[model samples]
Target: MAAVIDERPHYRPARGIHPLHAVLLAATIPLFLGGLLSDYAYYSTFDIQWSNFAAWLIAGGMVFTGLAVLSSLIDLARARGRRKQALLTFVLLLVTFALGLVNSFVHARDAYGSMPDGLILSVIVTVAAILATWVGFSSLRVGVTP
Candidate 1:
């Protein structure tokens, strides 16, 4: 076989987020999702412990989300360009964090009282968390435009 000429354009080096930051961002999804699941279990079974589990899970998710938001901010500040896209992901994370906080509060109420509202908030927060994670990860590239 004849050797073929290979050619490619050189581009700027890729920069990426810290591994820990990525872990924190990834962790937010499952915890929030778990909270949503727990809330649903409580709703369907009327078992109070499930709500308690949801509260704790929400609290954990908030912690991870808060860290992820801060880390993303640092990453955003360091990177030039792509502000609009990054900002959208950042906003989604912020919304998820805020809703998770509120959900935690709702879960603090008496088991019966926290029901529908807590369940609803859990759903919202979980969706937001997933959106945030998806946008953040999907939009990031090593050395290319997102």
Candidate 2:
């Protein structure tokens, strides 16, 4: 039993980050930003409505990404040497979702420029992400402690 448990490692087939993950990440950022811009400035300045499209795209992308992140988190926890990546990915995805929620309100603002909403959100996300990454990396080094 011990020999089997400690045998030389061999690669096992499994799913990893697919190409679609990158596509989703790329699409979400621009879509959410554009949505906020249109809601706050573009529509007011010009007679147009782009928010509906941007909002839909951003929402769909984030929902898909959130699920993917959760799946990867589970896989990473089970796979050797992949846990840190998984935890960080989960945290980052969460931060993106948080920012998206904030941006949704920012778009509703009448005086968007006067407020530093974007900067504040960036700082909040950055701090939260840094903490999450630190905890995750440290756990990887320490192993799963009881």
Candidate 3:
């Protein structure tokens, strides 16, 4: 009698950050920064008109980025089994989202100088978003096969 050998491929789960998440992070960071810079220029110069289009673009990017980060957080939680980190990321994401909303509504008055509060809020949100993104991305685990 001849011995039979089973040759079955082992199933490997998908790992690491999703490509979509990475792309979204890459895109959102620039858009968010650009919009803030444009805002600063408009405020500092007092001569240049800030484009509403840019503001809208920033808002959209923030929304998308928030969603992407949330997705990544869920993935990280599952892969790394770190619920605390995920929870903190979620809180930061919410803060960023709220700040973005406030930024969109508050407009700089042309006659008056730039609003210091708005600028400060924007800076805060930008930093928080970046931090959250870094944390979420770092927690992801890449699957390697040798």
Best by TM-score: 1
The local distance difference test score of each candidate is 0.84, 0.49, 0.62
Q: Which stretches of candidate 2 lie over 4 Å from their true place?
A: 1-15, 18-30, 33-44, 108-146
* Model number with the top lDDT: 1
Clashes of each: 0, 0, 0
lDDT of 3 by residue, 72-100 (tens): 56654664445666666666667777777
lDDT of 1 at 57: 91
If the candidates were sorted by their lDDT against the true structure, best first, what order would they fall in? 1, 3, 2
TM-score quality measure for candidate 2: 0.49
lDDT of candidate model 2 versus the reference = 0.49
Could you give candidate 2's per-residue lDDT for residues 49-87 as a string of tens digits? 444544454466456546545644664567555666666
Task: Please identify model 3 stretches exceeding 4 Å from their true place.
Answer: 1-14, 51-54, 69-80, 108-114, 144-146
Better of 1 and 2 by TM-score: 1
